[model samples]
Target chain A: MIHPFQSVASNSDGSLLFFVIKNSILVYSVKDSNDEFKLVGEWSDEADSTAIIKEKVTKEQQRQLAENTAKKLKANDGTALPQEHKEAKIPKPGQGAPPIYQYIRNVKLSRDGKWLFACTDSDKAIVMFEISAEDKNNCLRLAKRQRLPKRPNAITTTIDDKQLIVADKFGDLYSFGVNDDQPCVNPEPILGHVSLLTDVAIGLDSNGKQLVFTSDRDEHIRITHFPQSFIIDKWLFGHKEFISTMCLPVWAPELLFSAGGESSIFSWNWQTGELLDRFNIAELIQPFLTENHLAPDRFQNKEGNLIEYSVSKIVTFDSLPLIAFFIEATKAIFTCQINRDSGKIALKQVLEVPYNVVSLACAETTGELIATLDNQNSHDKNFVAFISMDVDKFHINQSKQQKFDDFINSRLSDNEIANIEQEGIYPLYHVASLRKRGEH
Target chain B: MRAGMSLDDPSSRRQSYRAKKEENRKELKHVKIDAEVVAEKVELPKKRYYRQRAHSNPFSDHQLEYPLSPNDMDWRKLYPYFYDESKGDMTKEVTIADIGCGFGGLLIDLSPAFPDKLILGMEIRVQVTNYVEDRIIALRANNVKTNAYQNINVLRGNAMKFLPNFFHQAQLEKMFFCFPDPHFKQRKHKARIITNTLLSEYAYVLKEGGIIYTITDVLDLHEWMAKHLTEHPLFERLSQEWEDQDECVKIMRHATEEGKKVERKKGDKYVACFKRLPTPEII
Candidate 1:
């Protein structure tokens, strides 16, 4: 099986690109006018893989034993389950976890293009790297690997790029100095939500007051004061499903677009928490709903025919006032144009590709949308395609396309490819799993 | 033998279990109908029929329904007396919230104490929540002349996940946490009601000088709650003298079912109170 990029991101000038495959990060620099990718850097964790697997087996056995005892006892009142509660173990980051635990959840680049940030589930830590393109062989240099108390789901930097804010699965947001070397032992969070935070962003209000926006699994978008995060400003509360991704358009700073488990994208005025428009895509994407969209067996009801969808990525172009988003496990990407004065979105076009998209990125300077594909079915090894943004025509045309040919795929050893074939590709479509079907 | 025909077959057992669950649902509905729809002087729901487990997993989706925002919530269904339909708004909003309000003992005690303010009890369990609803209905029916219980109501909600969906910013004046689940295990500490992160959410819905009332039978859990509340930047711990003088604190001590049980056993009861402070200015 071929490995699809779990995440993709680009820098300010679109000169550098970042992709995550399993636990490692691959960096590529767009070479020249023709738009070819050159492998510039690579980074991987140093933990012993064999030891990690062995420890996982022991932990699994213990968990099964405890579960069996609890099941047999039928202790719903909890008073008769003292034995189970007494021996409950403290949670550790990397102990006895699944394969997703070893994969990097997300990767981010600084606005200045001088720094890169990535979070991994292995050690529950965020790794920062210094990017120096002048060094041909080694563009990324390890800066720091600061371990957090919980597994981070999303990360972003402040407007000044001086502070890194991390949102974790445990519903806490912690901010650390970008250059601080402190130990960060038992640090308290600056803000928190009662639900799992899926994404975090920083934006400025109309008066230039800095604010932080966070979305959670419970379909809430909370906006809080920047440095004084304890002071919550307001909540954008029209979404009825878990919000997985949010985009703050640079062209219209006051306009916010959000999408998640629901089949529609909502545009909002972030300052006033007023919903400007809801662009429904259920009818347009009806053909894209496949058997894979069905709810899992555990979550299925008597009918067992429930289908769900979630947006995987939402991007905005700097050269044009357009928003483009891709739904998980779908073969097409949707684009829309924003009316600047009213903050309303109108559907512009849908660009259908050959394969399902794994992730998407907007190249700031080139005015191109880069989409990574799940190319397991095809013999083609080229995994990324760049689509041109016809800004003058107000269209994202797929006819003018360029395939990104990089050395990363051809360079993977046969043994590594065979190993990936046996273990299967890392989960490329995970947004739909965030939907709640009300099952335990 | 055929697959589902055997007595010990898994399918047979599942069928019987589902049948029993359906029957249980019908009976619960009947109980609700008797309390709210048919009776003018309703009988209080029996506690034995509504018994359930003490703890529920906070992370699981419990099939709950909530409004998109505070504006979309229809308070008329819960508190018809306070809503003026012509105006399309409530005469007064819910100013007090009792989180994880098991059996609604505190709600009943505090209703007459603050007669002008609307109080709401939010519980997560299905059976326990139904019992509280039925109890409130019966009380209202029995006191129709004076309209005593019109200001109090019970809402089934996961307060941890949807508190802001039900209340606006600075809409609540007093919040209570009476005998919350201890979640004794170290890994389950995140599920506790009081933490550094959740305090910010609590502060968001509370007024500048709103009071948080807490009481528990477990010393460890009491200390844990106190420490987190005290360490929060927006909350200041009220001294013991203040707690003694506060009327709501005294009402909270003996007004909860858990408190009465602890008193019957002669166990220790710990109390803590904190006042929500003004947010500090950004430097």
Candidate 2:
């Protein structure tokens, strides 16, 4: 039922369910000797978020940060950021891009339902919480959680659930081992890439070996061994544009789905390094198209072609076979199913969202239907999701009957259509005919 | 009672529109606009685009309309001062370009310095370009001794988009990026005018051994321009000897309005010049 939150998870028994609502984790216990349900505990990330946001930086912290900035600026007065621009004269470490620390961008719960981990965009840190106990709403006491540095683009438990793997914006993959049920802050940098990594997911090869799948802004999907991440296994390099999200849909975990900054989604089999299918989502979003081009807000950087859109967030909803993802600029969520038999991703459903979906998390405890109800215009309680019981008998509902075509037809008059049709039709090798037509 | 007599039919309407357009074109061919006729119609449409100051998004409202190719542009209108009386034609090519030519100060100084070589200044701000045009026109009208300002013209266009449209291949010998808008924020670094993408365009139109002179008061921007220009394969850093010996470099330092302002404020004006290298041999 916690569909619109940062993360939601139900224990293996489906008796204890919890979701990150705002900064607090609302844990519910469905345990019943004679049919009873109760919220067992609540925990807040208020302190960590406040520290991460940095907008409310204390005077002393501001002073210190300013001094650090000035000293670096002095060093970089006559040079560009050496890391990015290699040819800059005095190449020096710790004097590149200015440090920007931001708040928690994601809240991820471990698969075994033992720990909840989150990563911030700018502060470059991951926080871990012990979410194992069956909680009583606002009644359970908690110990302090550990914080580690690195601006995390995505976080998840490793294949064995023994370590937390974090995808960083600075283009590094770090693995943190769990020591005594608590994730240690010291992370081992196991893998590296050359561009800002957007997302990472855990998947298994055909041989049943656990693998790490990562995507970056450079339009690359890399597959590496779970334990030995230093050795690159294969690169699924098909995306023509930057990849913003990666998902190993539970139903098709063998097929890696990469989206974002693209008009289509690519599904690759990490084991064999083969692109199983490329799903062109343009037709599904035809109604949202801005007549002559793709939606401007989504695909503004379409390199002068102008007609395209960018996908912001994509995630897997466990209970459903479809991929629950949202596209930015358009403010819409689409669920597409991977036809396991055909190895094709077929568009299943599309729902326009209220506001921009900055991030998304799975809520498998919720039913099959991805229902969204817009609440009152309050930051804390605008959108809500319910674990729908009516959608139990769910199938791929690809409603091909589009309502946008009529709208588009209504937008164009007959004269405009005629003018568009008169546009060459075919210029061919008719240079003389072009001159006769008075077309330059 | 025709079957499709509705107003939506475009074929009939297009025929009538074409007939009217031909009639108008015939009439336009017969009629001519003299200076007096132009002045009668101009009326200088209320200068609404003028600003006493420049904003970061000053030219955001400006349209990117441009000629399709080099042949489409009428070069005579761009370089009126280069009208050759002996040949009765205007074939004099523009050998220099001043991008973001704010107040026409650099162009004015270089007009007489390079009397035979045509110089063109591209400005996006409508009123700023209009002001530069008026200054050049006035300078031409007042002078009886020389055709100094005629070889110089200011066009209201984005140099980044329309450089190739205005110039032939390897047409320019010197390109000036004097006192360009800094766009100090890191997010605005790509818009710094000296990016690799734009340098390639500049290199395309600049003759081999041509010089690109850039001067700025902002240290960060100076470093950014220098680094990008140095890294560009088509360009190499000009020596200090050439920097001191070049006449246009001196004009770039002290002639532009921004340069004068920076000088008045006693700010550091970083100047760097790069020479365009010969084209690489393709296999």
Q: Please report the candidate that would top TM-score against the real structure.
A: 1
Model 1 lDDT at residue A71: 73
Tens-digit lDDT track for model 2 on B1-283? 4532334544476445435544533332222223443332222212222332564342132444456455556666666445565786776777889999987899999988888788889887655776676566555545534444667887777675346556766889999998888887654654567876457667768889998999999898899999988977779999889899989888888999899998999989999999999876321
Please identify model 2 stretches exceeding 4 Å from their true place. Answer: A1-23, A28-39, A46-102, A135-146, A181-186, A288-308, A316-321, A329-331, A352-360, A363-382, A387-440, B1-283
| Clash pairs, model 1 backbone | A1-A421
Q: Residues B1-283, candidate 1: write the lDDT tens digits.
A: 5533544445556555445544644443222233344445667866655666788888778889889899888887787778786998889999999999999999999999999999999999876887787788668767766778788888778888899999999999999999999998767888898877778889999999999999999999999999999988899999999999999998899999999999999999999999999978753
> For candidate 1, lDDT tens digit of each residue in A88-207?
344445876654457777789876677899988756888899888788888889888777877888888888888888998878898888888664767778988878889999998877
Minimum summed lDDT over a 10-residue window in model 1 chain A is located at: A394-403
Kindly list the per-residue Cα lDDT of model 2 for residues A252-353, writing each as its tens digit: 667677777667877777666677888887777766544333333543454555564566566565656567665553445677776775567878667654
lDDT at A355 for candidate 1? 82
